[model samples]
Target: MTYCVGMMLDAGLVFMSDTRTNAGLDNISTFKKMTSWETPGERAITLLSSGNLATTQAVVSLLEERPHAHGERDPSILGVPSMFQAARLVADTLREVIAQHDAAGQQADSAFGATLILGGQIKGGPPRLFMIYPEGNFIEASSDTPFFQIGETKYGRPILVRAYDPKMSFEAAIKLLLVSFDSTVKANLSVGAPFDFHFYRKDSLQLDTTGRIDADNPYLQLISQGWGDALKNALESLPDFALE
Candidate 1:
């Protein structure tokens, strides 16, 4: 299992994914779920994937190979024209990969299947974000809903609901995401460490920063601890549960 999210903000985009792929007890391993493609000052795109490992990997590998005129050989995200076009290509690629895999005798149902969060910008357009479905369709983030998450999102959604604001500055959004990730890491064992974060400022067409956050990282620890205590304090102060 995995957890990956892409947040669209007035400031730019925030993408994050946990590297842990928890198959079962004794089967855990780290596999980066974030993929990036860029043309430096021209375009920057990032994808966060969740679901079947084989299916997702095959989809991405084929996407990188999409440049044979039919967009079947480009291979990576770096060459797509616009963020919207890029997403369409990603969705189409995912469908093909799933069909090809299962057509040869593998289970590839759309439910409990792979999904992706795609985000970034082209030099001429504002940064945008989307959540791509297995069916080769997607929905973009809007001013009313400036972020999207795939996989185990329930654990972290409350923080996003409480803190996300379309008007927040870049730094503020990062802080919000950190808290959200911190909450997720604690409540779910299926999602684990070595988190990947990509921060882009709108129009930069270049990633401002990308880094791996592992366990024992000081700032993440602080955020986690603070959020835990805050939740406890809030619960303690709430009116007691009423008897039936």
Candidate 2:
């Protein structure tokens, strides 16, 4: 399990993902969950994934192969004309990859199932975000909902709902995501560190930041410690329930 979010903001796009994959109590590992493809000026596309690691990785590999498969050196996300088409291409390719794997009798539906949060911008457009399902269909994020999150979601969604604002600074947006990730990490062991995060400013057409955040990241430590202590202090200061 993991937690990955892609926020579509007026300023740009913010993406964050955890690198944990757990099979059992003793079987756990870390692998990157964020992938990006860009043409420097033409367009940029990012994929943040959660769920069956193999299936997600296979799908991503297939996406990267479009150009080669098409007998061209340049058919790719960066070549796609719009964020919409790029997402469709990802969904279609995911469906094909998963279906083929299932047909080979080498995997289970649940084991090959995965989900993605896709986001970025094309030359003439605003940033956009989409949630691609295991079935390879998806929906776009709108201003009414400026962000999309996947995996271990129920635990972390509330913070995003509360803190996400289109006008908020990019730094604030990431802080909000960290708070959200922290809450989920405390409640679920399947999602662990190190985390993958990337920031893409609108029209920049380059990765602003692509890095790993480990269990001991300073900001994360502060939130996990300071916030928990603050909550405890707040609860202790409140009147206790009367024994009625």
Candidate 3:
């Protein structure tokens, strides 16, 4: 299991994903769930993936290969003319990989299924974000739904709902995401750091910031401890229920 989120902001886009994958209590591993592509002044694309590791890796590999595969009809994410088209290409690739591995072919519940969050900007269009499913369909982020999450999402969703502000600075957004991720890490062993993240400033057509945050990072430690203390204090300050 994993946790991944992509947020659309007025300032730009922010993405983060956890690295843990496990088959059982004894078989745990860390694999990066974030993949990105950039063409400097032309485009900057990042994908956060969840679900079957093989399927997600295959989808990404195919996307990486297609641009250089001569006579390929489908453009790579890098070659796509717009973010929308790039999303379509990713969705198709995800569906194709799942179909190859599952007899049922493209079923969302198939053992080989994967889900992806695709976000970035192409040269001619405004930045965009999308959530692509295993069935070759997707929906773009909009004013009404300006963020996307895939995999182990329940534990961390509430903070994003209550605190997200589209106009918030990148610093603020990253802090918010850390708190959200900290909550998930506390609740589920499967979703944990070190987390990987990317930031793209709108129209920069290049990735602005990218890094990994290990469990020992001082700032993450601060957010985790501070948020817990704050939550406890808030609960204490609330009016208590009394049985009459």
Q: Top model by lDDT, which number?
A: 3
Cα RMSD for candidates in order: 3.0, 2.6, 2.0
Model 1 is weakest, by summed lDDT over 10 consecutive residues, at 67-76
lDDT of 1 by residue, 15-100 (tens): 88998886776799899999887778998888899998887888777766554346445434666667888898899888887777
Candidate 1 stretches with Cα past 4 Å from truth are: 67-76, 107-112, 233-244
lDDT, candidate 3, 89-207, per-residue tens: 89988887887798645455588978899999999899999999889999999989999989988889998999999999999999999998998989898888999999999999998
* Model 2 regions more than 4 Å off: 68-70, 73-75, 106-109, 232-244
Ranking of candidates on TM-score, top first: 3, 2, 1
TM-score: model 3 vs. ground truth: 0.94
**Candidate 1 displacement at residue 15 in angstroms:** 0.8
Candidate 2, residue 32: lDDT: 91
Question: Best candidate per TM-score, number?
Answer: 3
Task: Write out the backbone clash pairs for model 3.
Answer: none
Model 1 Cα shift for residue 229 (angstroms): 2.3
Ranking by lDDT: 3, 2, 1
Q: Assess every candidate by TM-score.
A: 0.88, 0.90, 0.94
lDDT of 2 at 189: 95
Better of 1 and 3 by lDDT: 3
